[model samples]
Target: MDKRLSDYIKKVVTEHGVTSTLKMKLLLEVFLRQSIFVNTSLPPKHNKRFWPSLKDIYNHVAAQFLKLRDSCVDQKLVVEMVEEQRSLHKGERFYIRIKKDQEPGKFTDENFGMTKTEQSMKLVNILWEWPRMDLPINKGTGNIQGYNIATLFAKDIKTKLKEILELEEGDKRCYEPHWRHLQWIDRNDLTDHNVMNNSVKGMEERNKLFHEERWAEMSALVLEEFGLFKPKTIIGLFSPPGYYLSLKNCNNGKLMATLEDETGQRLNEGVRYFKDVLLVEARIIIASVVKNITYREAEELLYPLK
Candidate 1:
């Protein structure tokens, strides 16, 4: 029979540290030997691959797949794929496909590209850069025609983020990771109150859309001393006597606020702002007041949820 593809795949397997796995051999055989439904108008090449049992094919394929790593693949290509995926701004959507280490993976029409609806960015490299920098992706960017470099990137971000941050399996985050906070803030002047308020709103949206951790409570001391600031979307939850949860819109900017006081009660948008804020708490210190009567101080800071 025509076993060219199968033999080639086997050779690849061996080159990548896989000696002999019946499952992989069988997988290559099936992929090469069977009739795949592509360009449907073509005649079927109905050839049954030589496999006595399913287990053999599975183990072989699994072994080869598990061995895939940076040493076995091109890091530059993978990084490019991920950056392209993020630039698309499609959000957390991705497709999975196996490809030759030297060649781009096959893209089938059946797979739909990743979307932002999921909240978490599933792209690869997420954990790798964790506790250092995060990447921000917006919603409704574009449509991916197929799986290739972009798909690899979407997968790598998650894997790398997890690796760098030492994230456990259960340590889940709901927001897509964002890295643009510093860049965006630095681009504008924060001295003007209106500008600061505008920047705060942007920061709020950034936090709301893409936090590193899920938190049941978050607080910001919106001092009246800072002048006028409006609420965007408003809500109230259980909180101490001096504070209340408020959502504000300032000069066309939107913000979600959680105000807390010494009474021990917590105030924030209960379910409207966050999809699932189940943890005790995490914090992001946007701005603060720490002067006599003439000025205030503001800087971006990150905190963990209890």
Candidate 2:
């Protein structure tokens, strides 16, 4: 490291403590990782590979550091660093003076303006000096009801099915009952049918599609509302392995449609519709779980659907 840069880093380490140094180290690591991608020709967006841009990587690492700064560990580290610095400089006096004609990029060559290490240091400085904001009370640590949204979605399918079934049955029996109800129960009569075809299989299929679509839309909307676009944000979806399989199917269908070149746009639209709907439903469920309320209550709180 350049002497000036090393001294600057030492100053930051002394003043901000080990947490700040760790933040700087992490930033540099991300910068190095991003450099690997930047040097390569980027893969197509449709290629489901981890190839993030330098800016994207920087933003991600910076966000993580910000979160760390807000945590108790960071607070404790900062206190310890400050104390250590004070003890080390007990009799020394510190002073700051600005030199004329000293530019910020004085250390680096014009062609390679700022090195990644220097850039990382700058990012650390900004993070340390910038004013921080508290997350909203409702956001609640990006967790729902003490469980991750994805876990809830994956494990609580039975409960969800029961709720939807009960609701549907109530709607049919009490809200719109008629002589047709008898026909629905009989299953032998073909003259009249219930709204949902009067079979658990039929009802399950309908509920599955409904919940799937709802989960997609709700999850997407929640992500948008909360400004969570990273892969980690997908945890809010509460998706199971099967849910991912469905998403894979959607992607494969879209890819096939693209290859066909006919009905491609329509296929894309259908896939997008289902995916969005499922994500949104996941987000709603996550919010509900975190807020310790019913899914319906969460829907109303975030975005009411009448």
Q: How many residue pairs clash in each candidate?
A: 38, 29
TM-score of 1: 0.17
lDDT of 2 by residue, 16-61 (tens): 5332222454444344357445576644534323433434433443
> For residues 1-306, what per-residue lDDT tens digits would candidate 1 score against the true structure?
235444545456656444334334545544544554233442343443433233444444445544555432333335446758877977776543335553343222111222322212221122212442243432223112222222322442223322322211231222223212211112221123223224655456445433442111011111111112222222211111122222232221212212212111131222212111111011111111111111111222222111
For residue 156, model 2's alpha carbon misses the true position, in angstroms, by 2.6
Q: How many clashing pairs in candidate 2?
A: 29
Off by over 4 Å in 2: 1-142, 157-267
**TM-score on alpha carbons, each prediction:** 0.17, 0.22
Model 1 lDDT at residue 254: 18
Give the top-scoring candidate (TM-score): 2
